[model samples]
Target: MVGGVKEEYQAAQELLTCMGANVVYCGPVGSGQAAKICNNMLLAIGMIGTAETMNLGLRLGLDPKLLAQILNMSSGRCWSSEVYNPVPGVMEGVPSANNYQGGFGTTLMAKDLGLAQSTATDTKTPVPLGALAHQIYRVMCARGYANKDFSSVFQFLREEEGQ
Candidate 1:
């Protein structure tokens, strides 16, 4: 997937053959397409998880922005935090808090997650989390916010009423 289309598909087919697996012709185009779907799905889930975790920190009164600062300065922060910035206002220039716009699209993510689920079922692998993630994204896409970024997952946070 990291390589160009031709290489990725060839690699997939080669791996399958090496493992004595059989399937229809999966060329570079196919591999690239599959990866596009899979990566976006996972990306959406990561965005959602990161947003929720940061919200949890806020509920602890850690000051999301401050906590985010600490994470960026510390090892606790990851790509979603350090690079993606899911808390919206925490990073001063991210999409999280601002209605989760200007980020990855929910529909794209749902499409990929759907592929992932299909793969899991075909392989008979345990991917309940992936399945659930796909379901959430499917619902998210069905909602009117289909135009927002994946970080729009923070919408879930705004909905939680904490008296």
Candidate 2:
């Protein structure tokens, strides 16, 4: 949670915890937002990378399930590649397997990426991949995938390739 004074921060955290939120006490008023921005930035990049990898694998005639398994077992493994594989049929019970519903929306991802870009600019930090990811999500939003789960990036990329 964001801060007011120490007591306020602790009180808010306690309240959030009582509400079943896994409240992490970020230092200052903006630090919680900063932390969330960073997290979503990384998540956007990972989701995009996972989609690209899966698309490439499919184009090369690799089985989607096998490719996802290989990626999960190899150095390429990440949450996106393993727990939330973007390719349909690669994993069940995730957004992709269910038509990209009921997960983090692309519009929200874009908004978070925009926040990351703004924060990076404010800090004079270089975030090349993060910037690219922001643009990707922005485009996805413009293309009408705003409300879809972010993992629908796989479908977006596939449609772009005329698959």
User: Highest TM-score, which number?
Assistant: 2
Off by over 4 Å in 2: 1-4, 19-21
**What TM-score goes with each of the models?**
0.71, 0.92
The residue-by-residue lDDT of candidate 1 on 1-163, one tens digit each, is 4234555555677675765554444344456466665666567666767777787887788887778788778766667778777666766556765667776777777777888888778879887777878887777777665787766767755554441
Ten residues in a row with the worst lDDT in model 2?
1-10
Give the Cα error of residue 14 in candidate 2, in Å. 3.1
Candidate 2 per-residue lDDT over residues 17-120, each given as its tens digit: 88666777778677878888888899999999999999999999999999988988999999999898888888889998888998999999999899899989
By lDDT, the best candidate is 2
List of clashing residue pairs for candidate 1: 37-112, 88-97
Our tally of clashes for model 1 stands at: 2
RMSD (Cα, Å) of candidate 1? 7.7
